[model samples]
Target: MSANASANSFQALVRLLRYARGYRRRIVAATTCSVINKIFDIAPEILIGVAIDVVVNQEHSFVARIGFTTPQEQIVVLAVLTFFIWAGESIFEYLYKILWRNLAQRLQADMRLDTYEHAQRLDMAYFESKSSGQLVATMNDDVNQLERFLDGGANSLIQVGVTVVAVGAVFFVISPLIALLAFTPIPLIIWGAFFFQRKAGPLYADVREKVGDLASRLSNNLSGIATIKSFTSEAREAERLRSVSEAYVEANRRAIQVSSAFIPVIRMAILAGFLATFTVGGMLALRGDLNVGAYGVLVFLTQRLLWPLTGLAEVIDLFERAMASTRRILDLLAVPVTVKDNEGKPLAEPVRGEVSFDAVSFRYAASGVGVESVSLHVPAGNTLALVGATGSGKSTLMKLLLRFYDPQAGRVCIDGQPIGEVSLASLRQAIGLVSQDVYLFEGSIRDNIAYGRPEASEAEVIEAARTAEAWEFIQALPQGLDTAVGERGVRLSGGQRQRLSLARALLKDPPILVLDEATSAVDNETEAAIQRSLAKIGHGRTVIMIAHRLSTIVHADEIVVIDGGRVAEQGTHAGLLEKGGRYAAQWRVQTGAMEESEALG
Candidate 1:
């Protein structure tokens, strides 16, 4: 990796460690267990040295210095202490495992939930720019990577530090000379571990990015498989996917190259430390400055302390990868929601569905291009139709009214109250919407209909379906209301999906209704049935309908023709035709279709 990439990885680690603030207690407990375990594990080496002294020096051994006086009894004491040390090591190992694993699981669950909740609260504009698979990869795959690291690598890292500190103290007390020799290589080992991390971290991060891209491509392709096959573009898509896969593989391989070199380099450092300690300590024993047993213990302890350092590279690698994922997860959680509830008095009474937009303007975040000042009104118990060519800001108007994106200028009002001053939940509750691009969850027909009103009774659901003119087709299904609608309602026809969307709105029964090209995809027969249902539902309710089909809105109580984001004309259908303007031109084209239908009839 380049120097900039290495620096970025370090910054990512710093950001990630900040998220563990909430897990401080667990981390402390786990670290304590790891330290205690290493302390106990170092005791066995001391015992081995004691056995050597008992056999060689007998009563004059160092065991006599502790008042054991007899070699046989000293052996017994050493045996019991060895058992206790091993047992204590085992107990702390268990404690560390339990604590670290629980911590890992808890952090994973909390982070995933928080990320998902934050994503939900974000503005719709953010979702428009992001892919579902990329978000899923962050929430699942990246989080799982962190959890796997915490499950073992965290404890290993803590234990390695404990080993170095505790064993270093022992070696110093025994013989500072040999301790210096053994400790000489530790700095080099640590430096090598860090050097490897600096190289591998960016490679792992790139690997993760490549995986996210691959997931996005797979998800998009699968969702559009029908179109791909229709156009015979399967081979092209496969080749594209292969290229992405190869990029991911190559990134991982680069990381492996650096990671694979870590252990061998670390092993050489350990060898240097080991040989220095062994040769020097043995020569000193021969010079009568150190006893045979003491020399034995020093050799065994040096190996016990330094051998584990060889595995430090692997643990650091895990840490680096986990830190990369953690940074992404934290960044997601840190994204502030631009759209939030306003602090205002709650509505005491139900809304009357009076909607008014006073010179509202909006621009998408990506392009900074938007509609200019525009205004319209729909009083209670009235219907308003918006007709325009594409890009004339028809849909943007609906989004502003719904508070999906607040307008940069002017105000949107509901029942005489500016929507910006009202709680978002209560404001949305007062309105119902049905769009042409209908979405249905993977569930039974009844569930899809009752989605907006989950607590609605079965009878109420059935009644709503009947009002939407969907009950006839629903009852014809294999399981009546219980029939499964596959993912996004794929099992249902386009017309059926529209009816289900209408049923959902009827169930909501909000005083304000929006139909944005709701009947655009259905056949003439289905459209006629839906139009009849809309007529019944629109009575005494405020309705705003946007449509390219002029016939759908010719009977609306009032029509507002939008051109270039401004209201160009406002009148009933007949008034517009008499005026011989844009509305009339659109009406002429639609009426031509009607004339052809009549001739066929």
Candidate 2:
């Protein structure tokens, strides 16, 4: 390998070893078993020579020198030794397999979980810029690839090293000349492995990238399956997916083509060592210069030592694939968490519900759309509504309050303390958010409702559901609260999902509630019921509501009208209507649309 490539490999290995640190004891034990197994595994060749010596030398065999006097007794002694050797080999083989496989499973699981947790702690911008499918591929597919190598490749490599040492030591004890000849191919094989690794490193890295891209394509297509069907573009999507798959296949093909040439070339090198040992050792026996049994041992040991090197090519193949995957997995874990809680500050206690935006401003680094130089306040236990057109600052203001993104300018304060100075958990715990885009996991209805507060009692959960006006429909289902919501709550209608989300927030029951178009999906009647529920429980809590449907916020205690990222108007709903400005124009258009529809009907 080139120095640069070697350095990269070493760095990757060090990082991986850090993950394996906790399993060090098991690793040592497993490694000891592997070495012991390979030692005995190579002893069978030496045993073959012993059997031959017992036949040729009879009472004068090496066993006689050790203790036995009769050939029959020596043969019996050899049998017992052989039995133990094979038994030891078999026992350690079982141990290493169990140890290595279990290690792979545990390590992979831990790596996946850490990567996912770190990903969650990253800022919103990172996720917005990256592909979800690629992230999923890293957490699932790439980690699995690394696990596959740890399953067998790791053991094979250790055994190969043991074979070289054990067999070479035996050969040198008999004849240094034969040992030199038998070991001639070792350097070539080692060089071939390094050569293949350096060449295959980037190829497999590209292969990993290609596979991740393919996964991204598939994820996107599946997520947009509804849109694809509505547009009748299945063939187009199929073509795009096929193109992505072809890129992956071609990348793998390049890696395979290079790796496939490895074993055969190394096999030829192995054959040269085997031939030299067979011819030279046979000649030594003919001249009576070496014992026949010794010659036999040399011949057998030579092949055992060098032929396994051919499989080294396969081991290197697995190692390279694993290293590629390891880098990706490590890269994910290495992502800096820019959105974490301030370590210098602790979460606030006894939150009062008052909120303020003191000249707050924020602009998305990527999208360039955010609230700008805006200021507002809602007193403790008062409802405030923010109304604006799309691309205005309504949602951006809420995001700042939630700390999903920190503002570029100004401070958002809750009950006099700047939120940025409070612990993120404390700030989030103080507020409940029910957004327009409701998401429910693949679980029963009760599970999604109690998501925010999993330890809530069944009665408390039911009461929250009733508060969101979702209890009636949930009861109509055959399983009631236990009914499955399906993927992203696709089993329920939009309004039903929104109500469940409201129930989730209601269950949280924080001091402050932010409802951003939370009732958009529900009909007027259900919306009214939810508003009534909100009105009842919302009395004691500060409410920050964002709605494009201005009617929902008409009853809010204070209404702030935003236009072009600035506050255009602020008053009670009646006061804004009396001003006859933008708010009046929006109210006229919406109410007129409703009236015309009713008249036509």
Candidate 3:
């Protein structure tokens, strides 16, 4: 891994640990259990030394020095203490396992939920630059990595620390000279860990990026399966996916190559420590300076201390991978939310639904994309149609009204109150939107229609469906309202999906409605049927419709012609046509083409 990436990853882990402050109590309890468990676990080695002393030295053993007085009574006392030591080790093991695992589960759930909620709160501009698959990877795969670490890494780290502290104290007390030799290799092992971490961090981050790319490809392909099949590009897409999958595998292999070298180097260091302790302690025993039993205890404790250091490779590998994911997840959490809730007074229940755009101007960060200074107003219970060529700021106006992205200049108002001064949720709640690009989740038709108002009754859903002219086809389905719509409602026709969206908006029954090219995708016959439904639905509601087909909205109360983000013309449809301006020219061109197509047919 590069130095810059390693530093970034380290910072990410610090942030993640900070976020985990809420789990401090659980972490402390788990760490305490792990330490206590290791302490008791090392007691058996001490017991072995005591047993050796009892057998080899009779009444003059270390037990007698501690005032036991008799070999037989000392043996009985040692046996009882050994039993309790083993039992205590087992008890703490259970406690650590339960605490750590539960902590992992709770932390994973909280991180996933919080990430998703934050993602939803982010502005549309953020989403435009990121893929759905990348977001999903952060919420699911990244979080699962952290959970895996917490599940085992927590206990392993604590135990490693406990082993060092507990065993180092004993070695120092028993024989400081030998302890120096045994502790010499520990610094080298720690150095190896940092080196491995530096090399592996970037590789793991690359692996995460590759996985997100692979997921993005799969998600895009699956969503566009119909297009792929129609174009007969299955082989092409399969090859593309194979390339992405192979990239992911190569990324992981790079990380594995670096991580795989860590254990061997660590083992070499451990072996040096073990052999040093063994030879020095044995020499001390022979010189009568340290008892044979003490030498036995040194051998056992040395193995207990050094062997677990080999497992450090596995724990460090988990830590590095988790920290990589932690960085991505935390970075997402750190993305500054440009749009926030307004601390303004709430709109009264009986809002008039009047909307106004005062000199609004917006330019996307990318080139050749923007809406210039624009102004317009639609009174309550009136319908306004926005007509223009593609890229004429027609749709951008709707986005501004919905507060998806606030205009860089000028103000938007709802019911005479500046939208900037109205709480976002309350302002949005007063408006219902149905866009040209309809999206429906995999669920029954009834459920999709009632998405905004889940508590709405089945009768209310059916009524909305009827008003949207969707009830006839819905009832004709095999299971009526209960029929499952495949993923993204792939099972339904495009027109059917749009109707369902309309039904959803109708169910919401907001005071203001914005339909941005809502009927553009449907055929003329279906469009006429939808228009008939809209006529009745728009009565006494503030409706703003954006349409490329002028014929569908000719009856609208007012028509505003938008060109290059400016209001070129504004009046009733008939009045605009009489003025022979931009609106009249667009209408003539569209109607003339329709007549030509009809003649040709």
lDDT of each: 0.88, 0.89, 0.90
lDDT order, best first, reads 3, 2, 1
Model 2: weakest 10-residue lDDT segment is: 1-10
By lDDT, the better pick of 1 and 3 is 3
lDDT of 3 by residue, 1-601 (tens): 3677668767987798799999899989999998999999999998898799898998899899888889998999999999999999999999999999999999999999999999988999999999999998989999999999999986897799889889999989888988899989999988888888888888898998998998899999998998999999999999999999999999999999999999999999999999999998998898899988888888899888888988788888898889999988988998988877775666666888898999999988865566888888899999999988889899998998888898999999888888877788888879999999999998899889999999999999999999999999998999999999988888999899999999999999999999999989988767987898899888899999999999988999899888887888899988998999988888889999999999999
Please tell me which predicted candidate would have the highest TM-score against the true structure: 3
Clashes of each: 0, 0, 1
Better of 2 and 3 by lDDT: 3
Q: Estimate each model's TM-score.
A: 0.96, 0.95, 0.98
Give the Å shift of residue 228 in candidate 3: 1.4
lDDT of 2 by residue, 347-444 (tens): 56678899999998888887788888999989999999998898898999998899988888999999989888878877898899999898899999
lDDT for 256 (candidate 1): 86
Candidate 3, run of 10 with poorest lDDT: 340-349
- State model 1's lDDT: 0.88
Error of 1 at 390 (Å): 1.1
In terms of lDDT, which candidate is strongest?
A: 3
Clashing pairs in 3: 1-199
Q: Over the stretch 310-412, how does candidate 1's per-residue lDDT look in tens digits?
A: 8887897788788788878888888888777785664447678888999888878787655678888788889999998987888889998888899999999
